[model samples]
Target chain A: MVELVVFVLMGGGALAGGVTVIKARNPVYSAMGLLGTLFAIAVLYVMQLAHFVAAVQVIVYAGAVLTLFLFVIMMVGVDKEEDVRETIPHQRRLALALGLIAIGIVVSLVARGRFAWVPVASAAADPQATNGTVQALAEPMFTDWVLAFEATALLLTIAAAGTIALASFRRPVADTAAERTGV
Target chain B: MIPPPEINWFALLPLLVLGLGAAAVLLVDVQMKPHPKWLVRMAAAVLLATAAGALLQGWWLRRLEAGETVGTPLPFSGFLIVDRYAIFGTLLLAAIALLGLGAGQRFIVSLGRRAAEAIALVLLSTSGFMLMLSTPQLVMMFLGLEIGSISLYVVAGFSRQERQSEEAAIKYFLLGSFASAIFIYGVALVYAATGSLQLFEQQELLSRVAFVKPGVLLIGLALLIVGLAFKVTAAPFHGWAPDVYQGAPAGMVGFMAAAAKVGGFAALARIMATAFEGYIETWATVVAGIAVLSMIVGSFLAVVQSDFRRLLAYSGVAHAGFILTGIVAGEAGIGSIWFYLAVYTVQLVGAYAVVAAVSGASSAGSPLASYAGLAKRQPMLAHALTVLLLGMAGIPLTSGFIAKFGVFQDAFRAGFGWLVVVALLASVVSFFIYLRVIVTMYMEEPLEDRVLVLTVPLRLVLWTTLAMTVVFGLFPVPLLRLTAISLPL
Candidate 1:
C-alpha cells in the first residue's frame, strides 16, 4: 500500500512537471519544472532500489545540470514571458496529432497487456544478490572497465579545454603592445 | 574476491601515445608558450610518433599472423580487440588526422593564442575515434563516440567571431545528443533483451536461444541503425550535415566530416557484421532501402546547392549511401567498404583543403561564385580540384571508380542488384554536380580579383592525396591486398 501510494505521488509529480516544462511561458519556470521532473524521476529510481543511481540522478541532473540551466537562462536575461505566437507553420497541430498517436499506441498496448511478458525484478529471488550497489559498480569500473573509465578523463579534459577555446577571448595584441610600451 | 582483468600493455601502446601527446601539447602550450610554427611542428611530431606506434602494432600483428608468436587477439577482457581490422582502422584514422593537421596549420594559426587548444582537440578527437574503432563493447563504443563528438561540438564553434559557427555547434550538439540518447536507449533495450553488453556475447546468446521477446530486440536494432545513420549522415538523417559543414571553419571541416564518417561506419559495420550477423536477412533489406534513399536524395540535393561546402556535404551523404550499399552485402563487403572510406576521406580532406586555401581558413561559407575562373588564377589548385572532383565523380582512372565498382560488385553478388542499379543511376546524376563545379572553375570569367595561394603544407597534402587517388585507381592490388588481410576477426 505504501509502495502504491509512493508510485502514484511520484508518477503524478513527474507528469505534472513534464507538462509544466512545456507549457510554462517563462524560461525560468520551465527550468524549475524540469528540476521537478528530474527530482521526481530520482525518487522513482530510489523506489526501484537503485540507490546509487537515484543519488546520482539527484546530485547530477537535479543539482548541477538544473543549476546550469537556470544560470544560462538568467545570463540570457529571458526573465520576461515569451510571446505565445506560433513560430512554425502548423507546428501545434502537428505536435497535437503526433502526441495523440503516441498516447493512443501506448494506451492500446497497455489495454492489450502486451507488456505482460516483461520480467519483474521480483523474479530475481533476492534483489540484493544482484549487487547493484556502489561497491559492485566501482569494482568493475576499476577492474574490468578501467580503460573506459580512464577514457572518460580524456573526454572531460577535452570538454574543459574545448569550452575554454570556444568561449574565451584571446587578449588583443594592441593591449599587450600598449602595456609593453608603457612598461 | 574477484581478480582484476589482465592488462594488455602492448595492445594499448598506440592509444597511450596519443593521450600522452595531447597532454604534452597542453603542458607545453602553457609552460613554454612556443611560437605557432613551433607548436604546429611539435604537434606534427607527436602525431607522427603516434602513427609510428600504430605501425609497430601493425608490424606485430603481421608477425603474429605469420605464426611467429602465439597470442589471442581479444584484449582488455573482451572490451577491445587488437586484430588486423582494428589496426587497419587505427592506421587510417591516424593518417587522416596527420593530413588534417598538416593542411589545417593555417587555420590553427588563425586561432591566435588558442592554437594549442585546437591542436589538442584534434589529437583528442582522433584518440576518441581510434578507441571507438578498437572497442567491441557497446557501452565503451558509446563513450568513445561521446568523447569524439563532444570535442567536435566545441571544434565546430571555435571561430567565436562568427555567429554561424555557434549556430552550427548548437545544432550539432542538440541533434547529436538526441542521437546519443537514442543509441544508449537502444543499448539498454538490447541489454534487457539479451542480458549482454559485449558484442561477441550478444552474438553467442542470439545464435543459441530463440528470443522470447523478439520485438524488443528488433526495436533495439532499428534504433541502433537510426542512431548510427544519423552519425554517418545517411539520407533523412542528414539534415544537419550541410549547415554544420558550411558553418564550421573551413580548415577543420574536412577532418570533422571525414573522421565522423570513418568512425561511424567502422562501428556500424562491426555491429552489423558481428553482433547481428544472425539477422542479416532482415537488416540487409532495411540497409538497402536506406542506401537507395540516401543516394537519390543526396545526389538530387547536391545538384541544387550553390554553396561549395554544402555541395560537398550532400556529396558526402551520397558517399555514405554508397558505403551502405557495400554494407548491405554483409561481412563479405567489409573490405570494399573500408577501401571506399579510406580513399574517399582522403579526397574529401584534400578537396576541403583547397576550399580552405581559396576562401581563407576562417571563412564560414564558400560561395560557388568564388570558384569562377579559379583555373586562371591558381592553376595548381584548379588542377588538383579537377582531379579530386573527378575522383569523387567516380570517373574511370580514379580511385573513386574502383571503390564504387568494388561495392557495386559486392552488392550485386549479395543480390542487392536493384539497389546497385539505383546507386548507379544516382552516381551518374552526381557526376553533373561535380561537373558543374569544375566548369565554373575552368570556363567562367573571374568574378573578382581574388588570388588563390596554397601553403607548402597544404600543397603537400593535396599532392599526396591526389597521387594516392591515381595510384590506387590504376593498381589497387596493394591496397586490396592490405584490406583483404585486415578482415574483422
Candidate 2:
C-alpha cells in the first residue's frame, strides 16, 4: 500500500511536470516543475530501496545544479506580455498514439502472468545494511574511482575558469551603442 | 546476485595512465608561468607520450590470439578495460589533439597569451575520454562522462570575451547537468531492481528476471537512453549543438564534438550490448525512432544553417544518427561504431582544422560567408576542405563514405533493414548540404576581403589530412580487417 501511494505520487508528479515542461508560459516555472518531479521521483527511489541514490538525486539534481536553470531564467527574463507558443495541432495525435501504444504494452504484460508483486524481504540487518550506506560509498568512490572523481573536480574548475573568461569578453553595451551611433 | 567479476588490470592501464597524466598536467600548469611556447610543448609531449603508451597497449593486445595467455590487470580495481578498442580510440583522440594543437601554434601564440593552460585542459579532457571509453562499471562510466563534459564546457567558452561563446557554454552546462540528473536517477532505479551496477551482472539478472522487473528496468533503460542521447546531441536533445559549436574556437570545437561523441557512443554501446541486450526488440524500436528523427532533423537543419560551424554541428547530429543505426543493429553494430568513430574523428578534426585556419584573426570567428572565393585565393586549403566536406557527405572515395557504407550494411545484416533505408535517405539529404559548402567555395565569386595564405605547418597538416581522407576511403579493407580483429567476438 505504501509503495502504491508513493508510485501514485511520483506518477502524478511526472505527468504534471512533463506537461508543464511544454505548456508553462514561463521557462522558470517549467524548470520548477522539473525540480518537483525530480524530487518526487527521488522519493519513489527511497520506497524502492534506493536510499543512497535517492539522496544523491536530491543533492546533485535538486541542490547543486537546477539553480543554473533558475539563474538562466532570471537572466533571460522575458516580458509577461510576450506571447507564448502553445503546442501544435499534430502534437495531440502524437501523444495519443504514444499513449495507446503504452497502454497496449501494459495490457499485454498483464496478460503474460507477470504481475506477481512479491514483497521485498525485510531490510537487511543494521550492521550489514550500513555497509550499503553512503559512508561505505566513500571507500570505493575514493580508491577505485578516484581518478574519475578527481577528473570531475578538474573539469568543474576549468568550467569556472571558462565562465570567468567568457564574462570578461562580453562586449560592453557602451561600445555596441557607440558603434551603432557611428562613433 | 554475484558481485562483479574479477578486476581486469591490463584492460584498464591506459585509463590509469591518462588520469595520472591529467593530474600531472594540471599541477604543472599551476606551477609554471606563461612564457615561451615550451609549456604548451611540454603539455603536448606528455599527451603524446600517453598516446604512445596507449598505442603500445593496443599493439600488445592485438598480438593476443584466441587462446593466448591473459596479461595482468592494470590498477584501480576493475573499472576500466584496457583492450585494443579503448587503447586505439584513446590514442587516436590524443593524436588528434596533438596534431590539431601543433597546426594551431600560430593561432594560439597570436592571441598574445600562453597556451599552457588551454593545452593542459585539453590533455586532461582527453584523459577523461580514455576513462570514459574503458570503464565497464556504471559509476565509473558516469564519472568519465562528467569529467569529459566539464572539460569541454570550459573549452567551449575558452574565448571568454565572446558573448556567443558564453551563451553556448551556459546552455550546454545547464542542459547537460539536467540530462545527467535524469540518467543518474535511472541508474538508481536500475540498481534498485537488479542489485547490481555492472553491465554483465545487470545482463545476467535481466536475462533471468526480465519479466519480474519489466517496468523498472525498461524505465531505467529509457531514461538512460535519453541521457546518452543528449550527450551525442541526438534529436530532441540537440538544441545546444549549433550555438555551442559556432561560439567555440574552431580547434577546440572540433575536439569537443569528436571526442565527446566518441565517449558518449562508447557508453551507449556498452549499455545496450550488456544490460539491455535481453530486450533488444523493445529498445531497438526506440533506438530506431531516435535514429530516424536525428537523421531527418539533423539533415534538414544543416541545409538551412548559414554559419559553417553551425552547419558542421548539424552534420554532426546527422552523423550521430547514422552511427546509432549501427548500434540499433545490435552485435554487428558495435565494432562498426568503433570503426566509424575512428574515421569520424579523423575527418571531423581535419575539417575543423581547415575551418580554424580560414576563420581569420583567431578572434573574428569563422562566418560561412568568409569562404567566398576560397578556391581562387587558396587552392590547396580549398582542395583539402572539399575532400573533408565530401568525406562528411559520405561520397565515394572518402573514408566517411566507406564508414557509412560499412555501418549501414552492418545494420541490414543485423536485421534493421528499415533503419538502413532511412539512413540512406538521410545521407542523400545530407549530400545537398555538404555540396552547398563545396559550391560556395568553388563556384561562388570571392568577395573583396578574401585572401588566402598558408603557413608551412598548416599546409603540411592540410595535405596530410587530405591524403589520409582519400587513403582510408579507398583502401578500407586493411582498416576493416584490423578493426575486426580488435573487436571482442
Candidate 3:
C-alpha cells in the first residue's frame, strides 16, 4: 500500500510539474517546473526498479542538463514574455479536444485492463549473468556500444566547438551614419 | 535450449567498409590540412572508392546464391539479414552517397572549414543507412536512425550564414530527439510484453500472447510508425522539412531527403512485413490513413510554394506517402518500394544538382524566380530540370512514371484496388504540383535581369541523370522484373 502510495505521488507530481513547465508565464519558473518534473520522473524510475537508470536520470537530466538549461535562460536574459502569436481560438479548442480524447483512451485502457505483474525469472532477468550491476552495463558499453559512445562524445565536443566558433564570430555592426558621411 | 545465433561479419561488410572509410578520411583530413584546399575532394574521392568497393562486395554476395554458395540466415541472431534484397539496397545507397559527395564539394567550400568533417559525417551516415537496411532487430534500428539523424542535424546547419539555418537545425534536433525518445519508450514496452527484440521473435510472441497484449503491441507499433514516419518526413511529422531543406545546403538536403527516407522506409518495411504481419489488417488501415493524409497535405502545400527547395521538400513528403501506400499493402509492397527509392534518389539528386548549378551569385542554390530566364541563358540546366520535374510528376517517358506504375501494379496484385485508386488520385494531384515548376520555367516570360551561370560538372551530372531517367522510363521491363523478385523481409 505504501509502495502504491509512493508511485501515485511520484506520477502525479511529475505530471503536474510537466504541465506547469508548459503553462508557466515566466521562463525561469518553467525551467524550475521542468526540474521538478525531472526529479519526480527519476523517483518513479526508482519505484519501477530501474535503479541505475533512476540515478542516471537524476544526475544527467536533473543535475547537469537542467543546470545547462538554467544557465542558457540566464544568458539569454528573457526578462519579459515575448508577444504571443495570434493563433486561432479554434486551433486551441481542437488541440484541447485531441488531448482530452487521448487522455480518455489511455484512462479506458488502464481501467478496463487487468495487467498482472509477471516478474521475469531471476536467471532470465540479468542479460549479463556474472555481474548484474553497473559493471554489466560497462561491459556492454566498452565492447558493443563503444564506437557509438565515442561518437557521442565526439558529437558533443564538435557541438561545443561549433557553438563557440559561431558565438565568437559576432562582428560589431558598422556605423551607417559614419559611413554615409565618409567620416 | 538453443544457443543464440553467432555474429555474421561477412554479411555486414558494406557497413564496415563505410565506417572504416570515414575513419580513414578523418585521419587524412586532420593530418593533411591547410596545404591543399582540395583535401576535401581527396577525402571525397576516398569515400567514392569505398562506395565502389562496397558495391562490388554487394554484387559478389548477391550472386553467391546463383553460384550455389551456401546461403542461409545470418547468425547475427536475426539482428541482420544477408540476402539479395538488402545487398541491392546497400549498393544503391552507396551510389547515391557517392553522388552526394561529388555535389557537396562546392557547397562545402562556400561554407568554409570543416569540409572534411562534413564528408566524414556523410560517409558515417551512409554506414548507418546500410545498417538500417540490413537490420531485423529494433535496437540496431534505433541506433542506425540516431547515427543518420545526428549527422544530418550538424549537416543542416553546416552553413553559418543565416539564422534560419541555425533555427532549422535546432528545431530538427529537438523534434527528432523527442520522437526518437518516444519510439524508444514504445520499444521498451513492446519488449516488456515480448521478451525479445528481434522482429521474428516478436512475431512469435504476438501470436502466442492474448488480445490485451496485442492491443498494447498495436499502440507500441503505432508509436514506432509515427517516429519512423517523422524521419521519412510524412505530412503530420513534416513540419520541419521545408524550412530545414531551404535553410540547409542544397547538397545535404538532397542527400538527407533521399537516403534518409530510403533507410527509414527500409526499416519500416521490415517491421511491417515481419513482426506486424499478424496485425496487417490493423496496420494496413492506419498506414493507409497516414498515406492519404500525407499525399493530400504534401502535394497541396507544395503546389503554392515559391521556393524551389521548399517545394521539393513538400514533394519529398508526398513521395513518402506514395511509398507508404506500398508499405501498407505489405509483402507485395517491398519490391516496388525499393525500385521507387532508387528512381527517387537519382531524380532528386539530379534535380538538386540542377538547383546547385543554377542558384546564383547570392547563396548555395537558386530561387524559383531565378529560374525564370534559365532556359534562355543555361539551356542545358533548364532542359535537365525539365526532365527531373517531369519524372517527379510521373509523366510518361520518365523513371518516376515507371516507379509509380510499378507501385500501383503491386497494390493491385496485393488485392488492394481501393488503395490503388487513392494512390492514383494522389499521383494526379502530385502531377499538378510538379508541373507548376515546369510551367514557371517555360511558359512564363523570362525575367529580364537574371543571368544563370551553370557549373560544367553540375551540368554534366544533370545531363547524364536526365538521359538515365528517360532511358529507364523507356526500357523499364528489366527494372520492373527486378522489382517483381523479393527476398526475406
Q: Write the per-residue lDDT of candidate 2 for residues B1-489, one digit (tens) a residue.
A: 224344444554555565566556545656865552665566577777777778777666656644365654343554566665666667777766776665665555554433544665676677776677776677777777777787777777666556776777788889888988888877887887788877767888888874754788788889889999999999978998888888876656777788888888878887887677778899988998998899999999999988888898899999989998888877667767877888887778777778877884254257678787788877777888899888888889888888898889888987889889989999999999988888889998987555655666567667777777899898988888866654431
Candidate 3 regions off by >4 Å?
Answer: A1-132, A135-183, B1-8, B34-40, B56-72, B207-213, B361-367, B448-451
DockQ values of all predictions:
0.40, 0.18, 0.08
What TM-score does each model's chain B reach against the true chain B?
0.98, 0.92, 0.92
How would you encode candidate 2's per-residue C-alpha lDDT over A44-152 as one tens digit per residue? 7666556778898999998878987888777877444655465687887888999999999989988896767643422332323543346567666666666555556
lDDT (C-alpha, whole model) for all candidates: 0.88, 0.74, 0.73
Residues B7-121, model 3: lDDT tens digits: 4456656666677666665667567664223655565565566556656655666577578566555545456676656766677777777667656657756544566567767
Better of 1 and 2 by TM-score: 1
How far residue B100's Cα lies from its native spot in candidate 1, in Å, is 0.9
* lDDT string, candidate 3, A57-79, tens digits: 88999899989998988888879
Measured by lDDT, the strongest candidate is: 1
Off by over 4 Å in 2: A1-183, B1-13, B16-36, B59-75, B111-114, B361-365
> Highest DockQ: which candidate?
1
1 versus 2: better DockQ goes to: 1
RMSD of 3: 7.8
Candidate 3 pairs with clashing backbones: B359-B365, B359-B366
Which runs of model 1 end up more than 4 angstroms from their true locations?
Answer: A1-51, A54-130, A170-183
Poorest lDDT segment (10 consecutive residues) of candidate 2 chain B: B1-10
